[model samples]
Target: MTANRVLYLLGSAAPPVLNIAGVIERAQAADWDVCLGLTPTAARWLDDELPALEELTGHPVRSQYKLPREPDVWPPADVAVVAPATFNTINQWALGITDKFVVGFVAEAIGKGIPIVTMPCVNAAYVRHTQFDASIATLRVMGVHVLYGDGGFVPNEPGQGRPNGYPWHLALDAATSALTRRDAGRE
Candidate 1:
């Protein structure tokens, strides 16, 4: 199977709220299979873009999981991205709680050695919390790439792209560069 399949786990963080498009665009350029894994909270913000994304990627966008109908038709993702990850989700996943399908999928991915990337978009208050720090440390130890969100640096104002601040495209570029390097060594 091609290793392009990606499970994008969404969170309620604001910056990731804006960076999802850039991430998806980058993933597509890298020939990745992008799947939208929305948390219950994320569903609220997905607004009208979810269906279009499903159509564009040609993969089912899922926030929940059912029994694998055919062993291959389920929530199996090669790479998983939890962007704008909330501390709640982080804590739950670290502790092995899968109440939400998104959390469940992440839990399973970690157990199976799937590469999972997490971009946390939280205020300074939550970011500095001790429990949040502990969760981040645990996730890193478990091989999850934790991407810190834009704090004071708002890429874009409300309802706009990061006009003047640090563009999220930079992150996408780095991710692609890393992939290119990995592929180069293989060749």
Candidate 2:
């Protein structure tokens, strides 16, 4: 991977979003030019850090749709990683509900054939809801690399969530692998 590779690291309002700065640094170290996008709530959560985050990525951290007249803000994404995807975000994405900027971009990325990797941060109780599993299945059917179950996110109990333990690496690895496979296909 070269520094020219652009990574769209889209985040939802999960506890792990707090660790985004560190994750961005890791991605940069791995040779990706990262662009950060956040859900509205996640943006608020990191409001105090937005300027620093933009300075770090060298791109604006966007949380809403740009005006139609506005030029594109960042380079095109070679891959996208949706980490700490929350229960609401997952369902909305699977159902084609593009109300939020993060979900909208990812949902469209599917049709654009942009490789996507996502790791849910929901709890065991939330997974028990019928819609949760169904949504995950739907995303997989639509070509999103959902990092759940055995090798990926295993839901913890609701009140007992571990923010620091979220596997950021899994989503990052999957994203880079997608880019690798894509590059291979070009040969």
Candidate 3:
């Protein structure tokens, strides 16, 4: 069977952001051809690991928007997962903002009918923002699978989250299930 091409988008969250290699490994084990994309802050955070990440995924790690005439490097995504999806990314994406490469790719993916799954790594304090709930609601309405709350990533109290506690596997599993559901629907 052909592997599913997954765009593994990252945001600037503490735990999962630092464990990107593990995320890639999990995705690959599940038969996904994973491409890594990062928010600008996330890119900066993972600066020293860029080379290793590129080698891991066999594609350039994209953080910024490329020049208009530049050729696209990664394969077309069969699905996209934004693990450690930060509050900023979730809000901006809900508002259709694409200033960053990761956001832009996901925005376009939605229109392209690619199944997009997001597991937000936000704190309870930030979740109180007026836009946060509305943003998630909008994304869910747009058919983005937001793995938050009870069945997914639960909000931790501010400054209490441990790197080991982040649910990286849940994000991958949600992506896989979404792809399966999409395929089953086509059949």
User: What residue pairs clash in candidate 3, if any at all?
Assistant: none
Q: State in Å the error of residue 151, model 1.
A: 13
Model 1 residue 18 CA deviation in Å: 4.9
Better of 1 and 2 by lDDT: 2
Model 1 ranges with Cα > 4 A deviation: 1-15, 68-76, 149-187
For residues 77-164, could you state the per-residue lDDT of candidate 1 as single tens digits?
A: 6556666566688888878888898888778877786666665555556656688878878988887766654322222233552322
Q: How many backbone clashes does candidate 3 have?
A: 0
lDDT scores of the candidates, listed in order:
0.62, 0.95, 0.86
Q: Candidate 3, residues 153-178: lDDT per residue as tens digits? A: 99989989867888888888888788
What digit string (tens of lDDT, one per residue) describes model 2 on residues 1-187?
4589999999999999999999999999999999999999999999999999999999999999999999999999999999889999999999999988999999999999899999999999999999999999999999999999999999999799899999998888998899999899989
Clash number for candidate 2 = 0
Candidate 3 lands at a TM-score of 0.94
Model 3 stretches with alpha carbons more than 4 Å out: 1-4
**Best TM-score among the predictions, by candidate number:** 2
